[model samples]
Target: MCTLLWQWFSEVELNSGELYLYHNSGTARRAINSNKIFGIGTPRYHFFNNLFWTESWWGNLCSDPPNWIGDYNVYVRRGESPLWDTQKNQAQAAGIDLHGRWAEGEISPYRDADEEDFRLMEKSPALDAGADAARLDGSPAGNTMACLFGIRLLRYGPGGSGRGPRRRDPGRLRARALRWPARE
Candidate 1:
């Protein structure tokens, strides 16, 4: 039985859709799954610059889709499992996650996941791991917009003092910049 974190059913149509610059962590099952008819599933699903971390053996990253385009992402697994390596290798061989890397560490890239602080650590490999925003086909990934928004919110929003440094990093949030302020 394959449990999925994000699943697309056969009824939904996703053409030229892009999924990028997101961060998915924790003990979920598969990160992405799709319903297939015959052997082909959805098409034109592009994934880029995302991070996936899992602590369980059931944490398969993606299902095999014929035209899925994925790259520049990071995959991290905590415990030892042959299934994890095998599935990852199969995904690569099947033309998924071509430029993606398997981050090897027991420690999470985030500062304190247990505390719900999804900030990237100073030495995190995911710091500069994202692809250029302009290179993506669609409107830039939400992460870029969120970073800009987060900055504005911090500088000009309600309690903001309107005076602070702004920096940018890869992944879901402006984690490195927001969490660890830049030093003079």
Candidate 2:
């Protein structure tokens, strides 16, 4: 069983402003049991431009939070009907991932997940399928730096002004070059 985000509070804390933003991330599991992508937890969360792949019915277990918002994410489930995915449908019905998409036939969006090459394919739906991330925080989503597997990459905001190459591809890596730094 693999879980991504799990949060639990001993006491209820309403409107604590504990906002968590999960953007351009990927989570996958090979198990076929009832696995949870997100555990029941407090704190509002925003999910955007992510890829979730699982082989269980309980792909996402935390969708009851009123303040939790999600959009422009991809969901892939093994052996599930292409027309409908229960977890994605439930999230959409609850107004969480209104713009989320489901990958048919459990097709992986990554180039080679087995080898841990998470780069998106050339025709991947995740390419340019992301909404402007600024909408989540009402601030310009510029100058954001992400570290993937210890490789640091830069993401430019509006007008393509920042560091490194200008690529707006969605998902965590954003199709940037992977630099391996020497371990100390």
On TM-score, the candidate that comes out on top is 1
Model 2 agreement with the true structure over 1-184: per-residue lDDT tens digits? 2222333432433322222234444554531122223433332344555656655323334444233545666666656543345555656676766776666663776789789998776656566565553444344456354323222344458865354433222223232221111123
Which residue pairs show backbone clashes in model 1? none
What is the Å distance of residue 122 in model 2 from its true position?
A: 1.5
lDDT of 1 by residue, 1-184 (tens): 2233224444533222222223333334444555444334444344566666653222213444344556666667766655687777677777777767677666677788789887777766566675554444324444334241111223346776655333323223223211112222
RMSD of each: 11.9, 12.5
Against the true structure, what is each candidate's TM-score?
0.54, 0.52
Cα error, candidate 2, residue 172 (Å): 21
Give the residue spans of candidate 1 off by over 4 A.
Answer: 1-27, 35-40, 55-67, 136-184
Model 2: residues with Cα > 4 Å off, grouped in runs: 1-17, 29-40, 56-67, 81-84, 134-184
